[model samples]
Target chain A: MEQLEYEFDGAGSLRQSGPAVLVGVVSSGNLEVLVESAELGGRGRVVVNTSVRGFGEIWQAVLTDFAGRHNLANLLISINDAGATPAVVSLRLDQAAEEFYRGEP
Target chain B: MTTTSCGTAGQSYYEANALKRITSLLDPGSFHEIIRPEEKISSPHLRILGQPCSFNDGIIVGAGRLAGKKVLIAGQEGGFMGGAVGEVHGAKLTGLLQRATEEGPDGVLLLLESGGVRLHEANAGLIAVSEIIRSVLAARVAGVPVIGLIGGVYGCFGGMGIVARCCNALIISEEGRMGLSGPEVIETTMGVEEFDASDRALVWRTVGGKHRYLIGEVQRLVDDDVAAFRAAAIELLNDPRPLSLEELQKEHGMLSDRLKSCSSAYDAIDIWHTMGIAEPETLPLLDTAAFHKAVQHVYRGAA
Candidate 1:
């Protein structure tokens, strides 16, 4: 397993402060994303723990693209991946963000 | 969209994840998870073994309400490690049952979808399963009824099958299967000729919900829909069958009778035939309603 961490500047904070929103599941070729409000000093942080090794560069590119698309200020995005592709990772991240913004249980 | 108190119509419980099952089965907005995913409490042994870890250790546990009644609930994520029980996952379930004994909830609903103990952490997982069984019995002894719902993709097998049987009652769907040994494991251990794992029809007939309900192994058999499961759970909470010495004796007598009657039976069809069902071959093709109608006359109070 490889652990990857990335920090990005936030575009804005979340609309509502609520409990964490989780999306997806850690299965073969799938991943789980947990998005929660945290004290990150106005910056977004993502921690990825993946079973697929030697993908640090790809994770960086995908996380960078994700951070660029969403306003992740004061949010911590933790991912537990099991060989998910970049497209699935991106989709789960977006879904988690949507759930977080909607304040879903 | 027509939504009931539990969830929208036509939502398949077999496809839903652990959290989705819990939220959809319970009263809307009533599930408050004990250990949130953000807390990042996962299996400690997985990382060292080069395996990706789930945030909540593949099981979600917390307090919730079923049809306006207080209840404690737990759901196993079948997608994660086949919903196998490890140290943390088992502890969470044990803790919840212990809480149920103390707080004395209306009931404890267990959404069991596990294949069994995790082989990666073999000893710890096995020990955890034992502890969970004891805790479940303890809660039942304290007058807290424990109900199990088995309709997930992975089905319930291995140690979890024992756990499900220990519950006061079980609500299963056609897709849910409960057995001590899984088909694949049997095929691997005793050759495909002995138990063909690829034969889905044979596997279902042996351990699936329809057969289990007909044989009285499960209390209720409903459709695969989440709404159906929710309704069944609400109805069952009104009738909690706590364990008793008389119940055990009755169960033992039923088991002995079954062994004597079915010892020479070749397959589940033969068992069904012995149970006095005419045209037992047609059972597998029948829908849930038709299956119930066909077996209404047969004595199904035995295990």
Candidate 2:
């Protein structure tokens, strides 16, 4: 088991402030992402707790790529991963973000 | 492309996913998930074991309308760890049943597809299942009907099997199986001579929908298709029947009588004969409707 946390500065901010939004399932080769409105000072923070160990670099790379692609500012993204590929992790993060902002004013 | 609606042709409840089951069983677009995936209320114990945790803890509970009546729907995601019940998963079910009692839903539909208590969190899962049973009993006592829909890949086994049995009425498809221990477990513990796990037909004949229906364990038997399942749900929800104390007492008497009559009967065919079925060997080959028709003459109890 490995626990890693990272922070990234993003250009965009969350439009809505509400309880956390969760998406995806944590089965084999799958992961769950939780997106919550936060007081991150225009930065996005990510915390990953995974069963597959010794993948710190992979986690950082995937999350970094997601943060770079999306302007997830003032938000906290927490993930519970179970050996999901980079594609699945990115997709789940993107989905959680989309669901988080689906009905914002 | 033609847009096929739920319960339309080509959709089978036995093959549909948990989410699909919820959608098809209720009125179109009527299901509202409680503690949905985005809530991320996963199992804390699975995290300690370094295992993946599902956002809804592998069970989906929500409010829905069935036949114009308000109802609560619960479906298990069997793809997630065989739909095993852990601490969070069990509590979600318990809470849902409790909600049904307090909210006074016309009925509660439980789409059970679990292999029972998760070995990873055995004690917590067991205790939670017990709590769920308590809630089921409470809902019945409150005059809220609780129905079990059992038809999924894993089927309902272990503690979940007992929970299904506790329902006011159980609706099962030919593919649904209900029993305490799985055939593999029984074979390993009691030897292949006692129970052969490799014989799929024999196992189904012992615990599958047809046999359960014949034995009066199941209240309704429908085809594997989603339309059939939805129809059964609609009928039950529209006319909610909470189990009565007199009915419970009658069922208890029947079970005790069966226990005495079949104390040494290992084969289901023998039990079938005792139940007054003339030709038990031909039962497994019949479809749901035909099987129901055939058993009507032999079935004597208040199913």
Candidate 3:
């Protein structure tokens, strides 16, 4: 097997839009999320690069579900994943968004 | 804090500085640095990125005698661009500690001064932290002491915080701090009001020696003076039995109990008050002897 490495970026290009961006610190078993403002267009699109192959569709489904649920759009999200599970991924993403809007969560 | 007498002279990689501090209390000339920087074993990923390299990569590894006891020591030098570890840096560290399981150093002293992985060699640094965790588990399997010595400028953030937590024990200098996200990152991610990036007191309270010791995350506290560091190292290293699996299981159980009881708006001062320390306000100003004499660690069984 090749290096199980990956990177994903979602431009938060959706109809319900505001300015938010997410940049995650790449660490194994954990991650850091930065969500913030971005230029419009390329909205709601997510890009992923990983050593772990064949998980693109899984990510697409998860991210799409996430973006839709948050009603988040017009933002850029960049992640550096190190084999972290969907739960940790979700937690960090949620924290980033909450921190972004300074929302209590 | 009294300065420990240093017998070695050179451009001390923070790694060397760490070992020197420990050895100053040990017999002179008893220090034996293995897989040293002079070997020129470094990260190849940096070569790909056209970055300067370090011998032992940025990690310094070795085994030495302190107080007539043999121990293994490793330190990451943040001085070389904040002592970030790349692939090779990670590998050598993970591998040597793995070996320590069999060869067996009385204790593992980590001179931690890191901001996490080297972004230039991202994946490798990440991978190495994982492997090092595995080695920590191995050390646990064999019943050896594993420790984190946090004082260097990088202040042990990121995965290293978890790594420090994984230690069988811990030692911290007042100047050292440990946390997941750094201050700058906290500012960038959570905004200034959520956490002012420049407030030293806020930073220290969040992850500094006082907070860590109050929380029972740090086993012993010492001054930044190298001699104080050496004395602390010697004391912890002298412990014959480290935390056993049964003890760890119990501690884990206690942590669960703590989490269940205290998850809401708990402040650091709340801990000091609960632990029977006389005055939370004066704890910071107390000397090492006074601090040791006055306060009680709420969690007692980690070391």
Candidate 4:
């Protein structure tokens, strides 16, 4: 088990954010990401909770890349990860972001 | 939505995921998931275990319409931990049934595809399942029909199997399997001589939909297609049958008879022979309609 957190200063603001947007499953090789609209002083914070210990560097890299790639800001992101690979984590993060930007279902 | 060779709508229910099953079972675009993935209401117990938790906790509970009538829906994600029920997952199901009792939905639909209680959180999961059973009984007493649908990779088993048995009606597909204990567990605990879990044919004959339907364990046996399932659900919704004491007694009698009749039978083929199904070995290969037709003449109920 591993817990990691990071904060990325960003300029991206959600279009019509209200409640948090959740996406993905926490099955083996899969993960779930929850992004909430929060006041982070123009920076987004991400906290990750995962099984399959000893992957702190990979998780940090994935979150950093996601935060760097997207214009996502004014948010607090949390992830519940299983034994997902770097690619899967990145995909789920993108999906959460996409669902968040799309507004309510 | 897509069409199949059988002319049913969308993907087959056997192939669809939990979310897809919920969406297709209800009216088009009518499904609304409560405490959806975005809500992030995961399991606190699992967090302590350091296990990854799903946003919706593997069970999607919400309200939807079937044939223009309001219905509560709960679909379990089999891909996640074999769709095992945990604290939050079981709580969501129990809460849905409780709300249904209060709000009085026309019917309740439980898309069951679980291996039962989560071994990771055994006590909490077991307690939650018991709560769900009580809630189901309460809902039935309130005249709210509870229906369980089992047709997935992980068919209903364990405590969830009992919950399904308690439902007023159960709809199963040929692909679905239901039992108290899974084959592997049985083989491991009771030895391979008692039950060879590796034999898929034997396993299916014991707990698959065909066998269950033949013995009148399940009410309806439909194809693996989503349209087939949706049609069955809609028909049942229009004609809800709330659980009753008489029905429970009848079921108990039937089970007693089944125990006596199958006491000497070692395999499903023996039971098939006893039931007078010709060429019993070939039954599993037959389609749903053909199998039902073959067994239609067999008398079911107390001996």
Candidate 5:
């Protein structure tokens, strides 16, 4: 298993804060994303724990792209991956972000 | 990506993930997950084996309301490691049942979807299953009706099968199956000639919900829709059956009589024939409503 962490400067703070929103499941070729409100000081932090090793570079690129697309300040994103593709990872991240933004508990 | 719609009427229980099942089965926005995914209470053993771990160990257990009544609910995610029971996953369920015993709820709903004990954590998983069984029985003894629902893609098998039987009652869909040894496991261990795993129809006939319901192993049978499950659960909660020695004796007698009468039956159809159901062969093709109507007389006689 590989554990990767990355930090990104957010575009802006979240519109609203609520309980964490979790999306997806850590099944084969899938992953789970947990988005939580955190005191990240106007930055976003992502921690990924993946079963498939040597994907740190791909995860870095994908998470960087995700952060660029969404306003993730004061958020801590945690991922538990089981060999999911980049497309799946991005999709789950977007879903988690949308749920978080909706403030659904 | 699968849609994150709240458990709606038409949602298929077999396709929903563990969390979705709980959210849908319970009243809308009435679920309060005890250990949320953000807490990261995952399995400690999987990481050592280099296996992927889920945030909540693939089992979601917490307090919820069903039809505006307080209840404890648990759901196993079959997509993760076949929804196998590990130490933490089993512990969560055990703890929930224990809580039910202490603070008697309207009922305890267990949405079982496991294939068995986790091979990676075999010993711990086995112990956990036993503990869950004890907890389930304890809750029932304390007047908390523990109801099980088996309508997932994996179905319930192995140790989890025993746990399902231990519940006060079971609500199963036609798509749900319950058995000790899964078809694939039997095929691998005893050879395909003994139990052909590839023969889906044969597999369904043996351990499927319809067969179990006809044989009196399960109390209620419903369609695969979550709404149907919700309705059945609400009706069941209205009449909670507490555990007692008389009930145990009655159950034992039923099992003993079944064994004496149907032991010679080679297939489920033979058992149905023995039960005096006409046109037993036509059962598999019948829809849930038709199947219920067809078997209603037989059930009346059995009762």
Candidate 6:
């Protein structure tokens, strides 16, 4: 199979202020996340290690949109995707971000 | 089905390649590989695609001794399709837990490393993982300890990450990662300029093991070495309250608190600084021991 791995370093309060961190796995139509708080100074990051590569542009767009939409200035979001689609990924990222920040069960 | 490669997948073999800290966690030779690769547990769905099958369904299940107590162990073989869980693979895993419940194994140790369900056997794989989780919950109800170990490249992700979180206990090494969605998809839906999925430091800061431990999501954070993991598993097995209700509540509360704490905006470093931890810049870079000793945890004691 094809696998790709990389780490993303985001900027500003978007990186550190997030008392929450979201970790997840990417599969088509679905995703899982581990959202917890961090100590990094709000410069949160999103590391992507996936089996489906050659789509760096798409990934950047999705993450940037989520950060701006939710104002995720403090958390780092990490993920690994096999072949999950855009909708599934966004839902999970938002859910994870919400879980970490909102404290919803 | 390439039986030749199966034999090399023995516990010792896995032990050898396994993260260095995880070694010696279970009893010396108690590992009993179920659905052994040699058994040729291939994904039934693959036959339709004219693809060769694999033994153990890419998942190795069986019993092993963690210290002196008997512990059921299941590990994913990532070499096969990124170690996704397929129908047969999922069944074997569930079956192992089912049998463990029936026979009353001393404890259950899941050497979990998966990318969730196998697309080829989508529905079956999904059901298998779901059932497997139910079975593990059953084991927990029956007083059998369940330890979910995440210390590999694929790690506990997708639906499986939920399973891992639902388990009685969780252990994560640096090499392992758990999340719901990958960045590319998020970027596509949310926009590349918004998420910037290519940033490495950004990712690790959010979902990496250290933060999970800090927020008390992960019970233990050890070195990536297999031996350390093995030791932790062994220690957990010997304890009477290997997986206690009190601990689960604490974890659940952490989740709840996080959900409640969110506003329109949030970030990792701000969380840390607010928690009163100093010099936040290199926090994620700190090793397990260093972080544990250095950072001041926001949540003290258990729930």
Pairing residues by index, what is the TM-score of model 1?
0.96
Residues B108-190 of candidate 5: C-alpha lDDT, one tens digit per residue? 99999999999899899999999999999999889999889999999999999999999888999999999999999999999
User: How accurate locally is residue A104 in candidate 6, as Cα lDDT from 0 to 100?
Assistant: 33
Which residues of candidate 3, in runs, are more than 4 Å off?
Answer: A1-105, B1-19, B22-26, B240-243, B274-278, B297-303
- For model 2 chain B, where is the 10-residue window of minimal lDDT? B1-10
Compare candidates 2 and 5 on lDDT and give the better one: 5
Query: If chain B of candidate 1 is superposed on the true chain B, what is its TM-score?
Result: 0.97
Compare the candidates by lDDT and give the number of the best one: 1
CAPRI quality of model 3: incorrect
User: How many collisions per candidate?
Assistant: 0, 1, 26, 4, 0, 111
Question: A1-105, model 4: which lDDT tens digit per residue?
Answer: 778888887874554356676677777888878888877767888888888878888877888899787866778888888888999989889988877777644
- Which regions in candidate 2 have their CA more than 4 angstroms from the true location? A5-24, A33-46, A60-78, A86-105, B1-9, B260-265, B269-302
Q: Rank the candidates by DockQ, best first.
A: 1, 5, 4, 2, 6, 3
> First chain of model 1: TM-score?
0.93
Model 4, residue A2: C-alpha shift (Å): 1.3
Best by TM-score: 1
Residues A1-105, candidate 5: write the lDDT tens digits. 989999999876654478898888888999989899889889989989998889889998999899888988888999989999999999899889988888743
Q: Model 1, A1-105: lDDT tens per residue?
A: 888899999876544466788899999999999998889988989999888889999999999898888888988889999999999999999888887887743
Cα miss at B69, model 6 (Å)? 1.1
Worst 10 residues of 6 chain B by lDDT: B13-22
Alpha-carbon deviation at B160 in model 4, angstroms = 0.5
TM-scores for every predicted model: 0.96, 0.83, 0.66, 0.90, 0.96, 0.66
Q: Candidate 2's residue-wise lDDT over A3-103, tens digit each?
A: 88999997965565865776766678888788888788898889887888888898889888887778878888888787899889988988888777773
Which stretch of 10 consecutive residues in model 4 chain B shows the poorest summed lDDT?
Answer: B1-10
Give the range of the ten consecutive residues with the poorest summed lDDT in model 5 chain B. Answer: B1-10
Model 3, range B1-303, lDDT digits (tens) per residue? 123343433222233444345455345777666764324465677656544444345566777776677878787766554667678877777877887898887877777888877778777778888888889878867877887788776789887777888887777876788888888889999899778879877787777876777666777777666566666778877764555667788778868865755565356666666656667767777776777666644436343
Whose lDDT is higher: candidate 1's or candidate 2's?
1
Please provide, for model 4 over B1-303, each residue's C-alpha lDDT reduced to its tens digit, 9 standing for 90 to 100.
133243436468877778878887888778887877766787888878767777888899999898898999999999889999999999999999999999998999999999999999989999999999999999999999998999999899999999998888889998999999989889999999989988988888899988887787787899998888888888877777656677777778888888898899988889989988878999999998788777777846211
